[model samples]
Target: IFCSQYMSWTRNYGVQGTIFPAPNFNPVADAQMLAGALQGFGCDKDTLVAVLTQRSTAQRLTIAEAYQSVLGRDLIGDLREKLSDHFKDVMVGLMYPPPSYDAHELWHAMKGAGTEENCLIDILASRTNGEIFQMREAYYLQYGSNLQEDIYSETSGHFRDTLMNLVQGTREEGYTDPAMAAQDAMVLWEACQQKTGEHKTMLQMILCNKSYQQLWLVFQEFQNISGQDIVDAINECYDGYFQELLVAIVLCVRDKPAYFAYRLYSAIHDFGFHNKTVIRILIARSEIDLMTIRKRYKERYGKSLFHDIKNFASGHYEKALLAICAGDAEDY
Candidate 1:
């Protein structure tokens, strides 16, 4: 699912991740402490945060299993009763495996009356097809529902078609071709440049079908021939979620860390701070290129992501994020 591009990304930025499995861990001990924390009159929310956030997701999953075996209680269900809001979100997020967490978010986005279109766009537009496929499997296991079916029922028309194709989990992979890149660029140009009306399928096909390596080359060729970026052209012609999805694909292909940094920045800069989005990316990317994303955030926004988190978020939620924001890369 991932490519050598990500290795180059990690190398260029020197950002690996922020979290790892704790040394000399004891899941039974964790389960016991969690039981002790929850047994008191006033729940030890602080204890809950400490126990949950300090461990890796894999370790947390082990704790959940051991908690079940030792106390015969679901650690997550107990936490569900004990915590709320963003605090609960980050903690619960730590418990879910990455693919399942993504699946849960996708389910949340579509299960209710209205869709969180941005969440939908951010996830679908950003994930590799293999990640989406694993998420689909997790969604089915978690909810007994096919992701594609749910999406089909929840959405309609061109946007629906785009998402359906995206979820197919079959995109062009392997080597980048310079000659084919120029040809594909011309195809994309025709797709968006027609005077009568834009051919969205052409754009969707190119974005959904090509490998990121190939797409990067194609985007370079696209700018060379068109004299403007594809993103600018999309903004000039398209509207709403369609535009957002396409732009996300372009940003993701161009620089994934930058795309996430944009999301992180939006989550923080807006009124009231989009805490769910903030927590989602922060926790989700903690083990990936969050350090890279943080660097990009600073480069793009002229401020540190950690400084903004300290300023806007508080208590255990802030602490957990700050700890993860510590950078996965050793010596960051």
Candidate 2:
């Protein structure tokens, strides 16, 4: 996909001209836009699909209303008629009112007969902090069932628990007081140094529970008290997935870009790359923070992340991932 940059440039300048920026979403205006696109001259189905599917859920609703007012048609019903399964799925995902419903659907998919592991991985592992919270709410609202209960029934062991904890989305809002920040930092330092279960608990609290904004303040406090970067301490004491997880937390805490750079580096370096991990992270973060990941990759690795993936990975899966990483994968 990174190698395709040349092609992207060619498309930008040659035949395609420039891709139009997405319109500022207004439900009423959006209905007009959709009607115009549908009924007006030279409006492409692909363009309509892109615009309708890529907008946030709220924007989609507004556009839906607009679509009816302007075109006298149900946007979703029209979409179903014109688009096939894959595209329809993307559009429908966007059209759904609450994200929690989506989460609930994913949860049920995982628990239903013939479990969809990919859906589980995609939902549980990839959501933003805010999205995860919405999902928890959605699961409860849609099913009147605890998301955690479904997860426990469907998954086993520590990995299951980790996913549940993440979905639960509990975290401190912020640690503004310098004294409190220092105390949390001291606790983090002790945990990293000891590598005990207590350490994991504290690390999870700081990483998974706290907001990134708050964690950053906590990292500074850690540095102030310990005279060492939090990352260095974790690296020294922890090993394997435990270490990788903690490092991810710390990297996310200090610099998300740098953290992703590390992940990108891990994806391609050594004998065989962890393709699943690479694909999972890329897919999960692409919509949420991929632009930031691209920036971080350049700043930390001194080259495009896409370039490295192109150099290292092979085949169609590689191609799909590259397209995704390059920000050209069809929006869903």
Per-prediction TM-score to the true structure, in the order listed: 0.91, 0.56
Score residue 222 of candidate 1 by CA lDDT.
92
> Which digits, one per residue and each the tens of the lDDT, describe model 1 over residues 205-309?
888889999999999999998998989988887787878888988999898889999998888887568987888888888777787788899899998898899
lDDT, candidate 2, 1-332, per-residue tens: 43355335645553221122234445776677666665533445555654654454456677787777767789878666655533344444446655654564576576678655545654554446677777778777777887778777876643454556667766555545666667889888888778667567666665667666777778899888889988788788766544555566566556555565566676567536655446545544544566567777777778777677777765434444554455443332
Number of clashes found in candidate 2: 5
> RMSD to native for every prediction?
4.0, 9.2
User: Pairs clashing in candidate 1?
Assistant: 17-328, 18-327, 18-328
Report lDDT (CA) for all predictions: 0.83, 0.61
> What's model 1's lDDT at 288?
75
The prediction achieving the highest lDDT against the true structure is 1
**Model 1 bad stretches (over 4 Å):** 1-15, 195-198, 328-332
- Candidate achieving the largest TM-score: 1
Q: lDDT at 229 for candidate 1? A: 93
